[model samples]
Target: MPFAELDQPGDDRGELVGLLKRLGLRTLGDFAALAERDVAGRFPNDTIIAHRLVRGLSHRPPLRRALPPELAVTERFEYPLQRLDEAAFIAKALGERFFTGLALHSLACTRLAIHALTEAGEERVRVWRCAEPLTASATADRVRWQCEGWLARPDDRPTAGIVQLRLEPEEVIGGQSLQLQLDSIGHDVDAAQRAARACVRIQGLLGPDAVLMPVLDGGRGPGERVRLVPWGEPREATQEDQPWPGRLPTPSPALVPRQRQPVQVRDAVGDVVCCNDRGELSYPPAVVVVGDRPARRVIGWAGPWVYRDSAFAKQRHGRIQVSLEADEPNAGEVALLLNGAVGERPNWHVEGIYD
Candidate 1:
């Protein structure tokens, strides 16, 4: 008989061992001399099994229950599920079944593994781990979320409908005790769980690239100081040293592109007053038509101030560009401006502005 079958609640292993240890009946032959009723009276609940074991009647029966190598639940669909919604529904069901089995064993899972089989016989698998053991509903929700992510990828979609789904617990561990001192600060594990769930769901529907977080790169330039990366990836929280001298203490919220347009400035008297080049502006301006005609004029001017080139994009020509803000009444809106010389016309183009 399998060891698992012998380990059942009413098996003679425990009582026989206990009685033998107490009476010094170490051998099976010694135990076989004991009367059935005598052993039966000694252990009320397991007497019959204990007597059989003492009589050398092969107390172990054929294996009745089997132990799984690992805790898992699997479902094979008669029909393949083609839609993401259908797959998610099946995932949820599988999650519940998987968790139900774990709960029966008084176990909680910290890691979840999902597997999918397509009608074309292709298999896809994904694994996720959490900091804490999760409930059945939470586990199911996470499985669904992970399924959506796998389905969202262009290269990951199965050629045929998904015909198989499985959820397996990959890790099991104990839960941590809550800290009483941190209660007033409102930091709790539930919030983390909710955030994890939300992230998984969003990533499932929109792909992992959709979620991002800011990281510090530790350089003097706007491009150098900040970087965008996937939400869960580890990144340095702060920068240590400056890359260049004369860095701005306050960085602008937005990073405008380097390429811009150039413009010829004409004054109110209809004379070419100035040509603005290599200039930068902080904001957009109000635009109007010059001389009441269709031609636009910049009414307000801000800056031709120079700044360092963006670190995010490489500068091939090695020239720093200036940003400019201008108001053009002809455009009938305040806008931001960038100018680059366009074949001697010195064309003026509106970039964007505050409302």
Candidate 2:
């Protein structure tokens, strides 16, 4: 017989098997042959006990029933809540009640869970870890944050309004008096509470997606370098952790237009300037025409940085980015991205504007 049954998926005892194998013990017979004192000295006491049980020398204890947490509260809506604000309002009230209940027992919540049921019978749940025991206002902030994330995603939206909300304490600790510094701890906590409340109010007024937070991400271009995510959503740490090459050099552009704008570069006699396959310019640019506006004289121009699209080699082959400066003081410098290889008919669009 096998000394250990560890071939199953998600087997956590592979380390134990490896350790025993390293000690030249592959089967129960080999394990049983070892002296009990030797086994105890070589490995942990638990392993020695397990070996004893397998040898019929020791017996196992009876399993005990697990108990659920004591602090849990649920609220049902008379009219379902369609707006996130409405749900947040109810969640705040529920948080107050949850804390009050815990206070009666002289306890504090260290691990919190929030659950919601939509009219469509879909259930959503989230758990939050508290560094320390949380206060009532802090609990409400967490509830608001969870609700915002739920309502922000389009597919996660309820078919009807949410009909039920539940708050449960996963872990609790004995309540203790907190010694706080007035200027430091108290001020910081108060400021954070006010900010969290303000964020919820702003999200309620402007809509969830409207109140976004900037997240840094790895990309080769200016616009791709920054990702905007809904305020309550978690931002990945790996976004800014990885090294990104070919990013625009600092002083970065003030404006990066998501929608490409058509622009033309022309020479002195109004001949449209272009690039050739040899990565050479048709002529030194003399004028720049943006949309229907009159052409402004070009003072300086730089770069034709080539970027290859390895993913779509057939369609969007590559692009060349160039920065142009116009003579008119009002017309600031702008960056242009042109599609096609150096030697083909180039199609250009405005990429960014610098102040």
Candidate 3:
């Protein structure tokens, strides 16, 4: 139940969840730890339920209804799945098909039951509970994580290949609340407009900063580019289009640390990498070590770019992009943003991580 999954809350869906996820919420504990008032200040819409759900409280039956048996979708694999990854791959398609069926009925499900049949004639089952309707992709991921957890027990691992999988909708509600309804036909609520009104109401209650929203601003750094302002205000950027000479090139980092972590950048000869008075490197960066993380070889890089309006600025720093073997949860090529003062001292810090 991470913040990303918060949007998949049994009765919630909107840009609010996305915002929190981007703010570095990694698990249910992270969001649940926040004060309800702080969350309400940003979302304004019914975040009370999200706070309750994150704290493991159930408002389930109050917002959801019983689903019909027709919403279940099953699939028999042509190739039996011996590993959890194979089962996970098949679940993705099954989830999409299942939700498609639900959509036809103008319904969405909050609780789901996953059933599996093995070639040895054994059966496995588990139920997934969400405070809100989950997207098809989220449903598939939940099943995959469940399977991985179950399969992780060496002694309890399935003895035979899985031949069939079934997804059943145990609880459901009208599909209307999951996304903005723009159809001009019926009495469907305009979700976007309602969210705006909620923001206004919250601002009136908590004062102007009660509901702030993010707007992109002109800056060379990804962290500086994001600006949170009071909601319902004009977010005009007069200089975003202006060229920033030393800005780190796109695409931007996916994760920016709340605080910059001290790091060591080394050269080919094992000497610490440092910049000269002219902001040029003493030697090209060849390796990087952030905090206590394993050293990563710098295979590719850009910059040593400086940030200052004038050469004499005391608060100036240089930025660099280094591509290395990923040290992240998911194994992919990672690019790091590093910052250092514009001087001979070899101090450096990790500015961002591209996942």
Error of 2 at 190 (Å): 5.7
Indicate the worst ten consecutive residues by lDDT in candidate 3. 199-208
Please write out the lDDT profile of model 2 over residues 1-355, one tens digit for every residue.
Answer: 5756633366456777778888787787777787877877888766766667657684444568777446898989899877868867987898899989998888888778889898889898776655457688877877776776677658666567778889899878887733354666435676865765676556544555756777767665667777887655556545566554334455556677878777777778877677764446778777777777777666556655554444454433233445666547786665555433444455566766766
Instruction: List TM-scores for all candidates, in order.
Output: 0.41, 0.58, 0.44
Which candidate ranks first by lDDT, i.e. highest? 3
Q: For candidate 1, what is the TM-score?
A: 0.41
Off by over 4 Å in 2: 1-37, 40-54, 57-71, 75-93, 97-135, 141-165, 169-195, 202-210, 237-251, 267-271, 275-283, 315-343
Per-candidate RMSD vs. true structure?
18.0, 8.1, 23.6
lDDT to native, each model: 0.57, 0.68, 0.75
Better of 2 and 3 by lDDT: 3
Span of 10 residues, lowest total lDDT, candidate 2: 310-319
Residue clash pairs of candidate 3: 9-131, 9-132, 10-131, 10-132, 11-131, 11-132
RMSD of 1: 18.0
